[model samples]
Target: MRWRCVTGGLLVVMGLAVVHAALEHDEPIIGVDLDGNLFINTSSSADGHTRRLLLNGVDVLRELTELRQKCAGNVPRTTTTAPSTVAASTAMPVSYTGTVGCQLESVPSNVTHLFGNVSLSFCPLLTAESLKVFNELVYVSGDLKIELNTNLTNVDGLGSITSVGDSFFINSNDALINVAGVGNITSVGGDVDIRYNEALVNVDGLGSITSVGGYLSIFSNPVLDNVDGLRSITDVGGYLSIRANAALTNVDGLGSITIVRGYLGIYGNDALTNVDGLGNITSVEGTLHICSNSQLDTSTVPESVRSLGTCQVITSENCMTC
Candidate 1:
């Protein structure tokens, strides 16, 4: 059981190699799918080990380095692999709507572009080390989809992914206990949906992202306990929904997240006590639901909660009925 102590507020900096050093092969990096998506795996080892099948073999992940080098190192092939219209020096501008395996050393600041979307169902093996270097490893000009594959029990390398410019879909990243990359991303030109990652426990890195030009959805992350970084949001052109997080207790950090053009729904969360972080929301063109959390106790809620705009707070069980 290795305990990785990251520096204060610096989410997702572990190099792929660094995360590999922290991995314990006896653990399975891939997890069981909590939902029906065969591609969604969200289990992890509570003992604090990182596990994944990076290569054909399990654990040591020796081949990951080789594979990453191969996939990410694809500059324009001199001979031409796609077509006469496609540049002989590059991969055709095509977005793979299916799972594309990747072995990359580092995500480069520059990229190999062929205009199209790339869809990837999370492969069984990827550590924080590899994920941190993702921007320097793979090259994509359009959308990129990474559906959490199964059985993840740790939050090791998750904080490393910093950007998804276009539509980025990450569903069921269960067993994930930390969210570190949210600090580094300045914008998401497309929709950003993070749904059903059941084990998520913290929102440590999201303080840096000031805007989401598209939709912002966070649903079904049961173990999630905080929403501290959601303070700077002033506008979201699309829907903003937060549902089901069974153990979630609060939605602080947003004295300014009061205005939205679309629906704003927060329901089903059992432990939530307050929505004080909700600033001065005056109007919602769509529906707004903040109901059904049975155990919420407003008296016990943290002081971090800012605005109490029209909030129907849930009183604690011991309150005297006047």
Candidate 2:
């Protein structure tokens, strides 16, 4: 009988015509080459009523057998190509209405248009390096909310953004120290709320903002000493609230504001001593409420506001209902 076997490697066996006393041991055996295919062949023969065997291709069989024996104790190995990694410049732009988690170590530089809100709220591992992606962005077609990011120290990366299409809420960031990054933004289409930031000490970064389409509130910042960062604000379509800031000493930054279409309330600021900042405000179409500010100079209250009489401007702690 004769047969051939081909596999990842080659093997051959021959001769069943004569008897052989013993196998030879002097020749070097061949090894299975990983780069080549395996070829195996065998032949057999028989005589009437007698059986005899001879090894003709013993070298080929010996080499293949030796290779098989050598590899028996080791585990098989497989080859495969590696998966590709994402690069910041080639990533596609996307809109997110709900939270979107990103595992990439870099942010895309070409992103434009925020079809929906972009919130990085409560992201514990987010650092300024990851936010560098916003450095080139000039406009956000939706809300730009960055709050509760414990490690965020400053928003300087967002320096190029000129406007936000919706409300701008930056609150409750434990380690936030500055927002100088968004200083160039001239207007906000919705409410502007900046409160509860524990380490926030200044508003100097917000120097260029001139108007807010909705209410503007800055409250509960424990160490904030002044509202000077809001120096350029000229109009607020809704309420203007500056309250509960423990270290606040004055509203000196609001000197440029000329109108408040809604109510104006400045209360609960323990260290506030004056409203001298409101000197340029010519109109408040709605009621004004100024109370609980222990150190303000009642004399400094704007006459344009006190003349309304419909408003309350109480400086005394024991003052009765307005």
- Judging by TM-score against the true structure, name the best candidate: 2
- TM value for model 2: 0.66
Model 2 lDDT tens row, 45-163: 22223122234524334555566765554436688978669545754544323322333233356454445666778888877777777766677877878888898888887888888
Which lDDT tens digits does candidate 1 get at residues 211-250?
Answer: 7767777778777777776666667667777767887777
Model 2 lDDT on a 0 to 1 scale: 0.74
lDDT of 1 at 289: 49
Residue 55 displacement (Å), model 1: 98
- CA-lDDT, candidates in order: 0.54, 0.74
Task: For candidate 2, list the clashing residue pairs, or say none.
Answer: 1-44, 5-40, 9-38, 10-38, 10-39, 11-39, 11-40, 273-296
Give the winner by lDDT: 2
Worst 10 residues of 1 by lDDT: 1-10
